[model samples]
Structures are given as C-alpha cells and as structure tokens.
Target: MTPRRIAFYAPLKPVDHPIPSGDRQMARLILRALEAIDPAEIGPVEVASGLRVYDGAGDPAAQARLSAAAAAECDRLLSLYAAEPARRPALWLSYHVYYKAPDLIGPAVAHALGIPYVVVEATRARKRLTGPWSAFAAAAESAIEQAALVLCVSARDRHAVEAYGPPDQQVAMLPPFLDLPPAIDRSETASPPRLLTVAMMRPGDKLASYRLLADSLSRLAAQPWTLDIVGDGSAAAEVSALFAPFGQRVRLLGARPPADLAAHYRAADLLVWPGLNEAFGMVYLEAQAHGVPVLAIDNAGTGTVIRDGVGGRLTGPTAQDYAAALSALLADPSSLHALGHRARAHVEAHHALPAAAQRLRGLLTGLMS
Candidate 1:
C-alpha cells in the first residue's frame, strides 16, 4: 500500500534556509522528524512566499503593499490546494501559529482544504491587541478550534490549547525532539570550563539576555571559564559589544553550520541560556546530546527541557541568580561532570531522533487510519 500522504506547512520560511530565529529551527526539526519517520509518507511541504518587507520607517503605504502581496501569495497557494485531488492529504500539519498575518495563511488554507488540521508548538496567551497581528491571531485561533490534533511541546502550551475547549483526546503533548550527532571525545581536550549558548541575538528581550550574560560573567571574571556564543541576529553588534569587556574570555562564533555547532557542543562543558521568555528551548537537548548540561531560568515552558539537579540547574529569572548558579557549578567540576553524563543519558533515552520519529509516525498513521 502507498504510504499516507502527510502535507506539511511552515508559514515562516522553507526549513532548509538559514533563518535567524528559534522558531525556524523548530520548524526544520519538525519537518525532519516527520520525514525520518517515513520518507515516502510526507508529501510536498508548502513554503511561504519569501517576501518579508519589515516597515522600519513605519510607512503605511509600504506596509499596505507588502500586506497585499502576502495576501495574493496565500490565495495562490490555496487555489493550488483546491485544485489538487480531494484525497491528496491524509492530514495537514502546521508549525508555530503566531500574531503575524502571514503566519495564519497556512492554517486558513488547511481549513479550506477540509482535512485533519494539526498544529505543533502553538501558543495562545498573547497580549498584543493592535493592528494586523491581533486580527491574524484571532483568525488562527478559530482555525485551531477546527483542528483534529494540536501537538504541544510544553505543558504551558497544552494548557493554552485546552483553554480553547478542544477535546482532551485531540491535544497531544510531544516534547521538542532533536536528531543529535554522535558524541565527541572531550576527554583528550585540556580546555578550560567552556560555556556555550546558541541563539539568535534579536532586539528586545534577546538583547537583554546577552546583557545579563555579560553581567554574570563580569561577576565571575576571576573564574577560569570561557564562553562561546553561537548564531547571529539584529543585535549582533550590541551583543558583541556587551561581551567586549571579557575580551578573549567570550567568543562570538556567529551562526556556525550544523557540523561545527555539534563539535562546539561536544567541546563545551555547559550551555547557558538566560532568555526572559521561551516557548521551548531545543538548544538544551542539542547541548545534552553532546554531554553538555544546560543552565537556564526556571520559566514555565523551560521545565520540559531542563531537568533540575539531573541534567542542569534551573535558577530564578535573574542575572544574579544565574551567576550564582554558574559560580556554584564551576566550583564543583565533578558535580557538573555528573550532571553532564545524566544529561546525555536523558536526551538519548527521551528526545533522540529515532524514538521521536517513531512517535510522529504513529501519530500520522493513527490520523490516516
């Protein structure tokens, strides 16, 4: 029998491209995970129109033109869906529904197609209430209510979906999964306690996280630890400037390829992520797969990734708290080593790609059956 056709939609961009956001990374992983399950089972994944014109000058006319172009693109895609065979897709999967107008277009098409709609990593407790974002979010929620399954990556997101009154059976809680590369040999290296953090240095809260890291490192200048920050974003210059005081102590290795990143994770001792808000940080698993423990804030969605006292320590949401935690861990290298071992084991057992692929395949099969 032919494998069930699974249609995938990523509203932001094609997963294969380099986008400066965790959401894109997650989207890529989801597509990879689904494909790994059964390569032939997945069908053509829709790529959003690669037209992003941010209104930096806040020009209403420019914004209107961009919006009109995006709408036309959505209409074109929907028309293609309508022309396709009625039984083309057994189910439709969309990743990350946010306030962006273009983000909702995928769900709208899926709804019009009259297939089982599934959303992964969708959150609903947004506070912004002005402009197209608010309108888009409202429409997305309406589409979400029509979904047959909502795959939540965290308990917090699960709760948010539950608030929409979807049946309990329809909401599935699947942790963010990673296809970790083979473990690296860290025993031969005599490097100092190397810290790593991989994220896009965007404006707003992300910049604040970089500042917090700078402050935390300043407090522990005497300690023999080096930090390697991976990935680049809008505030790349500002983040580099913030870390300038540390000089050689902190290196900004901007957006290294996947292989290089895997090597860096293997070489590092710990992953420090001080984000003020995160839906579900996948970098924690990536670090753990290379035997690196993560030091993160005990935020709502973060608990799913960082297992306190086992994989890593979870400090309160403050730079001082993070600094204190880092100092204590660095003081006891043996403790950190033990946690690192456990971290690797935990990821291998739970978030490994093969297991995740199997689970995802089962979900798809169930939907189609």
Candidate 2:
C-alpha cells in the first residue's frame, strides 16, 4: 500500500513563508521530520494542503474571514477526496497551535474526513479565554480538544496543554531539535570575549529582551567585549537606539541566513539574550550546537534550552543579576571555555535532528497503523 499522506499546516507562518525566523524554520524542520518517517521505507511521504490562512496579528475579523475560507477549502478537499480516495490525507498535522494563530481549518477538515489530527507546540492559557483574543483562544482550545495528540516541545507547554487539553487527548513531550551541523569544539575563548545575540527586533518580549540586554551590558561598560546582534524586524530603529550608547562595541548585523549566523556563533565565545518569557528560544540551541555558551534569564521557556552552569548561565530576571553573571564569566575565561565544551556535547546528545526524527517516527507510526 502507498504511504499515508500527512497534511501539514502552520497557521502562524506557512512552511514556505518568505521570512527567516524561528517559526518558519521550525515548520520546515517538522516537514522534514515527518517525510523522513516514511512508514514503509518507501520514498518520502507526501505533505498536502499548502493553503496559508495566516492570522499572525490575532485580528478577529481576519480570523473570521480565514475560517470562512478554510470551510470552503475543506469542502473542496472533501469533494476532491471523494473523487479520488487514494489522494486523501490520512492525517492532518498542524504546527504552532496557540491563541494568536489557531488551527481553524484542521479540526473541521479532519473531523469531516475521519482522519487522525495532531498538533505540535499546542499551548493553552486560561487568561487568554477572556482577553481580546477570546474567540481565537476558544477556537484554539477546540482544536486541541479535537486533536488525537498534542506534541509539546517544552515542559512548561506540556503542563499547560495537559491541564487544559481534552482528557482523552494524548500529550507527549517532543523536545526542540534543530538541523545542526557537527558540533564545533571551542576549547579556547576569543581574545576579547566575543558576545552574540540572535533574536528579532519586534515589540513586546523581543524588544524587552533587547532593552534588558542593553541595560545589562551598559552596566558592564568597563569590560572589553564585542557584541554582535543578528536579527531585524519592525523595531530595528528602536533596537539600534537602545545599543547606540555602546558605539563601536556593538555591531548590528541584522537578519542573516543560517549559514552566516552559524559562522557568528562559532566565532563568538558567549551568547547573551535576556529571552524574556520566550517559548523556548531556538537561538540558544543553535548557539550551543556551535559550541557557544549562552546567558539567559531562567524563565519557563528559556530554562528548557540553557542548562545552568552546564551549557550556559541561567540568571535571575533582573539587570543586576544578568550584569553580574556576565562579569563573572568574563573574569573566568577557563570556566567559560569548559562551559562551551559541555554546551556542544549537550546539544549533540539531545537536540540533533536524528533524535527528533526517531521520536516523531515513534509517535506517528501508530497513527499510520
């Protein structure tokens, strides 16, 4: 028999979206992982439905329109499947199902087709139910309830998903993984203690992280370190202004391709980003995979990525604590080198693509059967 086809969707960002960010990268990674799990060891399985109903801004009007479009799309898909049963998707797999970007189409389509539906990185918070995104949140919750499985990437997300998800819905841990090259070996520190940060310059948490980093680094002005920032977004001007005082010490390289960014990670000795309430920053893993230690606040999402004193330092959520941690690391070069070495090993042991592929295969094998 032909392999079961998986229809993949990312409401926040499509897999082929014309943007270079963590979300897009993750969507692509999931597609690769699923295709690799060709159940019969035949060629790669097919991923259907390239329709993009992006509601990244959480606009209710936009969501309603997208839902209507999704309904029509579902009708078309069902009609097409009826005409050619062999081409029908066996499963609908959605990536990043949350309030701001809910899977409005998948649940209805899957239910109509009587196929198994799965979600990756599905988050649930009670507070969102009564907020401006109440409708979106409710829709997201409904999707979670409809899903046969919820693949969580962080412990924090798993707790929320398990707490609020349908009692019968299977919740499994799928730790974040990356398509990383061989881990780099950095047994020695750079001469001036190179620092790196890779995050978008958007408002809210992204801008806040940049602000906190600027404030913390400003406090350590006496120290000699070069900071290279690799990201660009709506708040680029604001982000630039925050680091303007640092002058020559700071370099904003803007958004870079993965290869270029990896080179910077390899060259840098430390990666510092406050990572205020992130959904587990993939940049931390990328840096560690390149043998670069990170300094981030110990929060729900970031804590999962950076192991304190192992891959990097997890500081408290305060400028003083962050500044102190940076100062301490700069003062002790040997310790920094040792941490970098361990960081590489930690990523290689856990976050590589093969490990993720195996875990995904195990989860999807039963679904196919």
Candidate 3:
C-alpha cells in the first residue's frame, strides 16, 4: 500500500528557524517523529508553511498582511502540487494553532485538494473571540472545526479544543516527548546544587516566570546554589535586571543549541523554572531525561510534564511557597538524588522518542484510514 503524503505547516514558527525556542524545537521534533515512524501506513511529510505571524503584540495590520501573503503562498503550493500528478499530498498536518497564530492557509488548501486536515495543538479560548485577536481567533476556530483530528498536548488545551470541536472531529492526547538519548551516569554529589532554567526571555509569561524566579530565590539568599539560565530574547534587558540582585550566583548563558543544552542538563542537579501558563514545557522533559529533577508550580501544562513530588516538586504559585520548597529540596541531597533518578526513569519510560513516534504513527494511521 502506498503511504499517504502529508504537507506539514507551523504558522507560528518554522521548524528551521535559527532561533532556539520551545515552539521551534517542538516543531522540529514533530517533523522528526513523523519521519522516524514507519511510513508504510501513515505518509511522507514535508513542511509547507513558513509564515511567522505570532508577534505577541496582536497588531491587526500585521496580522492582515501576513494572512494575505500566506493565502498567496497557499495558491502557489496548490498549483505546484497540481502540476505533479503522482506527488500530491494526501493530507495536511498543522503543528500549533492558537489565537495569535492560526492556520490561515492549510484549511483552504486541504479542502480544495480533497485531503484530510489535522492539527497538533489547536488551543481555543472562546473569550478571545472579542479581543484584539478576534480575527485570528475566528480563523483558528474555523480551521479547528474543519480539522479531522485535533491532537492536544495538555488537559488545559483539551478542554478548550473539545468545547469548540465539531461533532465528528477527533480529539486525541499526544503528550510532549523528545528525541533524547539515554541518561548519562552522573554523581549527585559531584557538584554543588546547580539550578538551571531554559526558557525564552520574552514578554508576558516568560518575563513573569523570570520575576517569579527572582522573587522566590531572593528569599533563599543564603542557600548555596548556582543558577544557569540558558535562553535569550527581546526581553533580555528586563530579565537581566530581575536576576541582577543574585550577584554572581545566577549566570545568564543566553540561547544555546540543543547539543550545548544537553551538556548543561547533564551537569545540572535541578531544573527550576516557574512555568507560568506553558503548554507542557519541553525543557522539563529534556531535563528529566538527563537525570535532572525539576521544581515548578503545578498548572495544567506544567503538571502534565512534572509529576509532583515524584519527578519534581510542584508547589503553589506563590514565591514563598516555591522558595520554601526549593529550600527543603536543597537541604536534603539524598532526596533530591532519588528524585533525579526517578525523573530520568519516568522520562525514559514515557517521554522518549520511540514512544512519541509510535503515538504519532498511530494518530496518523488512524487519520489515514
């Protein structure tokens, strides 16, 4: 049987973007997952959309211009595929769909091509329909409604996706995973308690997380821990100011490639980041896979990645609560070591590449059938 060909698109961020970010990393990971799977039943996949419209400012004019350009690109792709009788894609697979950046091209192209349309994380909040992102939100909802399947990563998104889903649309859980190698052997006592946080220094939630980290760590001034921050973005100046009070203890390493990040994770003891309104952070999974435990607040997305008290400690959203938890973990090295070990085992068993490839294969096969 011939495998179905899939045209992939990520309107928020292209997988090949030079910037190192969670969304780009996940987009690349999903592409790898789809390609790594046995294509006998699913299909060959290619990224078809490279439009980046998630400007964070919700600029209407910018959104409209990008939407127009994306529509034109859609026509170009349709014409290109039409010229090739044997190589036309049988389906369209969009990676991330939300109010800020939605699939403005895939739904129309897929419909005209008479192919199945699917989305990985189609986050929908009905309340966004009346805001500045109203047009984008409506487009996203229409795309989601036209999709044959919507694969949600977190329970938070699952609720919204299903709430606005078409009656015949399928909703499945595709928990976040990584194409990480096995955990290396590292002594828990070989180094000082090294805390690490890997996130973009963007405005809104990213900056808020930095603030939370600063506030929480301020109370633990006497604690002997070194923090290594591995990310950089437009909000660098503000984020730098937030951690300046920590003196030499906090090292801002800026952005790093995955290979460099993996080495840092191997040397680190704890992955501490206040995941404020995240979508199942890949950093937590990557850290856990490297035998490093995480400390974060329990939310819909972070909760899915960090198992409270098992893989990592999940505390209330208060800085005091987080600081207290961090202090307790630092005070007990043996417990932290045990937690790190469990974290590695948990990731290997559940969040590794093989598992994700299989899940994606099953999802794609189901859609094809």
Clash counts per candidate, in order, are: 1, 0, 0
What's the TM-score of every candidate structure?
0.87, 0.95, 0.97
lDDT of 2 by residue, 285-310 (tens): 98898888999999889887788988
Query: Cα lDDT of all candidates, in order?
Result: 0.73, 0.85, 0.87
Decreasing lDDT order of the candidates: 3, 2, 1
Worst 10 residues of 2 by lDDT: 38-47
The lDDT, on a scale of 0 to 1, for candidate 3 is: 0.87
List of clashing residue pairs for candidate 3: none
In angstroms, give how far residue 186 of model 1 lies from its true place. 3.0
**Cα lDDT tens digits for candidate 1, 212-258:** 87888899988889988997977899998898888888888898776
Alpha-carbon shift of residue 9 in model 2 (angstroms): 1.3
lDDT of 3 by residue, 1-369 (tens): 434888889888898788877899889889998899777766678888687767467788888898888889889888888787556788899999888888899999999988889999888867878878888988888999999989898988889888878788889998898887666887864445899999999889999999999999999988788899999999999999999988899999988888888889888889999898888899999999888999998899999888987799999998998999999998999999899999988888878877888888877787677
